[model samples]
Target: MKITFITVGKTEDAYLKEGIEKYVKRLKHYTRLELVDIPELKNTKALTEEQQKSKEAELILKKVTSQDHLILLDENGLEFTSVQFANYINKRSVTSSANLIFVVGGPYGFDQSVYARANDKISLSRMTFSHQMVRLFFVEQLYRAYSIIKGEPYHHQ
Candidate 1:
């Protein structure tokens, strides 16, 4: 199954961008991985938090297709160990889904509509993280999951 990461906005920091790219490249060796960026909402100074979320949700929904299994990266979602996450990936691949899309919403988080559309939700950690930084963490975790699945030396217990 293909794995796609959909995040809002661009990674402006060069160091973060480089790190994210490194992990994405490593993940490609294990699966068809792609990072899809949803442009940041423009002129948000006047919009309310709910309004911003609604607008961002529209863009996020557009990136997803009917066949894709949508998963949201939410703080209140389920947390998994490296091995469990690898098993999750294995199950999805075995089922032959078109794509496994994991989305990282905008600054204020996802709207109600986005939440309703998600099939599952995952939490990387209990602590909050910047959207750009989350990209790096998420991609690296994905790489680690793949390595664990293959019984490689990259991950340690």
Candidate 2:
């Protein structure tokens, strides 16, 4: 199955951008991976945070399909260890899902509509992270998960 990471906004810092690219490239050795960046909403001075989430949700939903398994990365989601994450990946690999989509929402988080469409939610940590920093962290965790699955030395018990 293809794994797609859909995130809102651009990675402005050069270091974070470079790190994200590195893991995205490393992930190719395991399976199909695609990274989609949804442009941030403009003229948000008039819109409330809820309205912004609603608009971003519309854009996010457009990239999803019924056949895809949608997982959202949110602070309140389930937290998994590296080995457990590898198991999660292994489980999805055998499924009929055409694509496994993991979304990292905007600064204000996702809309209620977006939550309704998600199959599962995962939390990288109990503490919060910047949306841009989460991209690098998530990708690296994905790579680490793959390494654990492959019996590589990247992840220790």
Candidate 3:
């Protein structure tokens, strides 16, 4: 199955962008992988936190399709080991109705509507990281998962 990462905002740091690109390229060898960036809301200085989240949610939801299996990268979500994540991806490839879509929300996190729309949630770690940094981490993890699935030498216990 194709895997898509949808995240809010752009990765401004050149180093982080390069890291994300590297992992994305590696992951493409295993699946149809793509990164979709939703532009950050403009002039958010006057908007409330809730308003900002809701606005961001609107842009995020527009990228989603009815056939997509939506998974949110949430702090409070389920945490998986590398092997388990690979198995989870395998199951989705065998059984999911559409492309597997994972989302990383804006700084203030996701809105209630976005939460309600997700089919599942995953957490990379308990410690919080910058939203831009998370992109690199998640893409690397995706590559790791695929490597594990194929019994490649890239990942080890």
What's the lDDT for all of these models?
A: 0.92, 0.94, 0.92
Off by over 4 Å in 1: none
- After the best TM-score superposition of candidate 3, give how far the Cα of residue 115 lies from its true spot, in angstroms: 0.4
TM accuracy, model 1 = 0.96
Tens-place lDDT per residue, model 1, 1-157, is 7888999998999999999989988888899998999999899999999999999999999988989999999999999998899898888888865699999999988999999999999999999999989999999999998999899999999
How high is each candidate's TM-score? 0.96, 0.97, 0.97
The all-Cα superposition gives candidate 2 an RMSD in Å to the true structure of 0.8
Question: Between the candidate structures 1 and 2, which one is better when assessed by lDDT?
Answer: 2
Where does candidate 3 stray beyond 4 Å? none
Candidate 1 residue pairs in backbone clash? none
Clashes of 3: 0
- Model 2: worst 10 consecutive residues (lDDT sum): 90-99
Instruction: Point out where model 2 deviates above 4 Å.
Output: none
Scored by lDDT, the top model is 2
